[model samples]
Target: MTALMTAELAWYATGRFYRANDGSLADYGYFLHLPFADAPLFDGKPSETSAHFTFAATPFKADGIDNGALSLGLDPVGQFSLYLQRRPGATFADPASFAQGECIATFRRTSLVVGTTVAASLTSASGAILGTNVFSARLIASNPFEFAGKLYDLAQTVGMGITQFGTAATTPVAPPPPGYDLVLPFTGSAIALGRAG
Candidate 1:
């Protein structure tokens, strides 16, 4: 388990994200889906063997940077939209902010019955083109295990990733391109069933 957690792991998460503008939620939210889980088949086979995101290394590194920013190494080209949040902020923050990144993962033991709590903060500094962004997550280990002074849990991890952008001026922008800044917020849970090669 130490090797798995310290090395690489694949996460299978089922969550939803909603787009809001001016604090008003959308009439309907959208569900998160694997990139090619339901896409056109090629050569009578699926595009990817697994839909889960593959981490090159653990996110709980001493520095908390992970093998690569979140999973930037997984898809450096950004073709899969693995980290679309970086798209608009390319100028403001490093594309691989998750690596040696501001995000921090920690584990603390509570009790055998209650389990341990795993949490991390997702954040980035101001970039040349974008302002700072913030997000966080917490996971409880219903059935906990300890390793190297750290607790490990394979239960459902729930958290939220939210960030707002655009002019904060109450007045509307010129006369086009919507009247307010864009707010992209998503909340959901992910489960780490096992590691991925």
Candidate 2:
């Protein structure tokens, strides 16, 4: 799929649960959001009018936490889903842009574990693959979540790394909010589009 060039904030992460770090339940996964260039979301965030993917995750260890937008504010023990939203309404079941007839897309991961594949598909108003992102996720958690992307390639949006939400940044079982991190340290090729996310 095409990259959101104007969306300056790029999020990075690395996740692993249930696994003990040196006999402790401390997680090495982290969530960090940083400013990036060359991507656009049409109407960027921090603005009233915005449209982009809502990155979220759900745990296999839980019993159905939340579905779409609800999961963004729920506990960190849920599966991950990317919901397309356009602000104004910018809400669950009814994103603001849904009424304006904006493009809609959905991204989901199979297992909410340390490593897995995240598949994303962009469709037209009638549901067609006429547009998209090349983001493919890596199935392993590592220190310093690496965001490998090639800016020279317009079809490169596939990045690898663990992405934790609303929870401990480095510790899996830790608390939330204070440790929210989306690590997208620009390596120039941090967003590899045209692949899988």
Candidate 3:
């Protein structure tokens, strides 16, 4: 048998939970609404509508912990897709045209990304590491499209970092590892479509 030395990253061992304003756990990973651009049609202009996009979060396993806190990384290894469910006269033949009857536009694009984050703990005065922070970088490419009879490419970069805050009081817990700390709260932004080679 082969000897194996496996070290599990903090982000994998410890799960991150998110709650909405009403305190319900937020299920979806990423959420956004993107509007379509106007295009020239046979008679009238192409219909303009918005597509709802959603992405689920998945963990990127790391090698090991350095310094004191745990480090987690994110790359665009996950899948990305889009949905357009409401359009006028939309159909497969004339998907985005006003004369068509198709109401949905679906596409899956190829993407990749790379980034790192530190897990820390939250304190009344100072902060610590609780091994629940997540950081990541992502590069996404839109499905190739032909505009004006020419092929064009579109891509995007997304950087994200997140941590939790607070803990259940009353349940006295043991101190974490020597350098480990508590969790902090964070908000992040996303990138849609960008130019790519």
Stretches off by above 4 angstroms in model 1 are 1-3, 6-128, 131-136, 140-197
lDDT of 2 at 131: 17
A best-first ranking of the candidates according to their lDDT comes to: 2, 3, 1
State each model's CA lDDT, in order.
0.21, 0.27, 0.25
Candidate 2 similarity to native, TM-score = 0.27
- For candidate 2, the 10 contiguous residues with the lowest summed lDDT are 116-125
The digit string of per-residue lDDT tens for model 3 on 50-118 reads: 222222233222233334543432233343232222232332121222222321222222333322234
lDDT of 1: 0.21
Better of 1 and 2 by TM-score: 2
lDDT of 3 at 170: 19
Q: Output the number of the lDDT-best candidate.
A: 2
- Residue 85, candidate 3: Cα error in Å is 6.0
List TM-score per model, in order: 0.19, 0.27, 0.28
User: Each candidate: RMSD to true structure?
Assistant: 17.7, 17.0, 16.8
Which one is best on TM-score? Answer: 3
In candidate 1, what are the lDDT values of residues 1-197, reduced to their tens digit?
A: 23223212223222111112333211111113322222221222221222122111121211123333231101011001122121122110111221221112222211111101112111221121211211122222134333335443333221211111111111221221242233222223222323223
**Residue-wise lDDT of candidate 2 within 1-197, one digit each (tens)?**
33434322235433332222222112222222322243343354433134332333332222123333222111122323333333433322222222243222122332432211112111001222121112233423211211224132212332332222222222122332223221211111122222243
